[model samples]
Target: MVGKRQSRREAVSEHKRELILDAARQIFAEEGLDGASLRAIAVRAGYTPAALYFHFESKEAMYAEVLHASLESLGSAVDQAVSRTKTPQQKLKAAALSFFQFYAANPRDLDLGFYLFRGGMKPAGLGHDRDVRLNAALEAALRPIAEAAIALGAPQERANLLMVDCFAHAAGLLLLLHTGRIRMFGASAPDLMEAYVDERIAQLVQE
Candidate 1:
């Protein structure tokens, strides 16, 4: 009974932590990291600033946690989509579409992961480690597709380069769409992504 009570308490703590992270993500997206304060996040999370400190040691820690959570969720979505499909080509296409769909569906999360946090300027300690892990997650998500392209007769180096280019293009397109800088074709970003994936897959398969 004591163990059960402890577990329940831990669960509640985790739930509250998640609430803090989510609130911080929204605040970061809207106001940028430098602009979003611990006090603001506490208000957003319906907690006192002291309560916020209990979950996160500092604003940077909270930001790191938010970025980690976003990457984990995105990585999970890509992994699930990759696992659901059989063929390498299908997996690649599905992964690409899944990535685009994730960003489109969760623009706020994307802004936190890709926009709010400057890549090269990531803090030197835990923040840097979190950034590395996030990059690894992204690379893992793309590995299956890169393997597929190589299996389809493209040179390994070329296939890897192509995969990188495709990711950059898709990410850039999404950013443009989000900022109202460009209107993507079709009703949704995924629809445009599907067509892009189809074309790229065909090119890689032929090469």
Candidate 2:
């Protein structure tokens, strides 16, 4: 009977926790991290601020949790894209496109993942370990894409460097496109990214 009561309590606790997180995610997307107050999230979750304290100690921890899920989704997209392709070239293209497209389709996720809404370079307050974990999540998401590049015959060193270069350019282009500056040049974001992938692959093959 005690075990049964404990299990029921745990289930209720988890449900409330998820409800709080869902509220946080929505507010973070709408208001950005800096603008999202713990009070607001708690209110949105229909819980008192004190009640929220039982689940999350701080907003930074909550932000990290939300961003972790976003990165996981990114990693999954790359994996599925790679799985669909046969050749290394195809895998690389697929992985790269999937990575870029994931952000392109969900601009809000980009804002959440990248802290685009924060003014100045204020720290996210996630602490050292959480920061490292978030970085690991991002690197894991890009790993498969890098592996695809390596399979195309580039050295591991070069493949890692190329992955960084390609994604850096993609990120900049994506930000510009999302902010409407890219259209000032009258070039499409997808077309530019596709062209970039082609150029990088061709260069990799040549080198």
Candidate 3:
């Protein structure tokens, strides 16, 4: 009876944690990071501020959880996209398309996942373990593209360089696109992304 009671308690705890995350995601989407407060999230989750504290020590802790979840989602999309393609060039193009589409569709998630503007800023209470996991998840998302480049005759070092270049190029454009900067030039984000992926694939084929 004690074991069954403990299992039920654990399940309940997990469910509540998920509820908090869902509420946080919505709030963050509506109001970037700074605008979303713990009180707002707690209310949205149908819990008191104290109850939210029991699950997450601070807003930073909760944000870290949300960021990690977003990274995992992007990583999964990349893996699935690559899996659908057989050739190296096709895999690279698919991975790029999957990445662009995911971020384009979920602008908030993209903002949460990419911390380039933050300049090494991490959420408070995000320990070394969380940092390692975040980096691992991000690398996993880009691994297929790098591997594909290697298979297409680029040396390992060259392939790694290519991966970094591709990511920086795409992410820079995406950030501009997200902030409506690209609109100044009368370009569509999806169209720009598709063309960028095509150019990358062509480069891979040539080298």
TM-score of each: 0.80, 0.94, 0.87
Residue 191, model 3: Cα distance from true site in angstroms: 3.0
State which candidate, 1 or 3, has the greater TM-score. 3
Decreasing lDDT order of the candidates: 2, 3, 1
For model 1, residues 124-198, the per-residue Cα lDDT tens digits are 434566667767877876676677777777788987886797688778778777887665443555566788889
Candidate 3 collision pairs: none
Candidates ranked by TM-score, best first? Answer: 2, 3, 1
How far in Å is the alpha carbon of 153 misplaced in model 2? 1.8
lDDT of 3: 0.82
Which candidate number maximizes lDDT? 2
Supply the TM-score for candidate 2: 0.94
**Model 3 lDDT, residue 7, Cα:** 100
Give all candidates' CA lDDT scores: 0.78, 0.87, 0.82
Worst 10 residues of 3 by lDDT: 116-125
Residue 154 lDDT in candidate 2: 85
lDDT of 2: 0.87
The candidate, 1 or 3, that scores higher on lDDT is 3
Judge candidate 2 at residue 69 and give its lDDT. 91
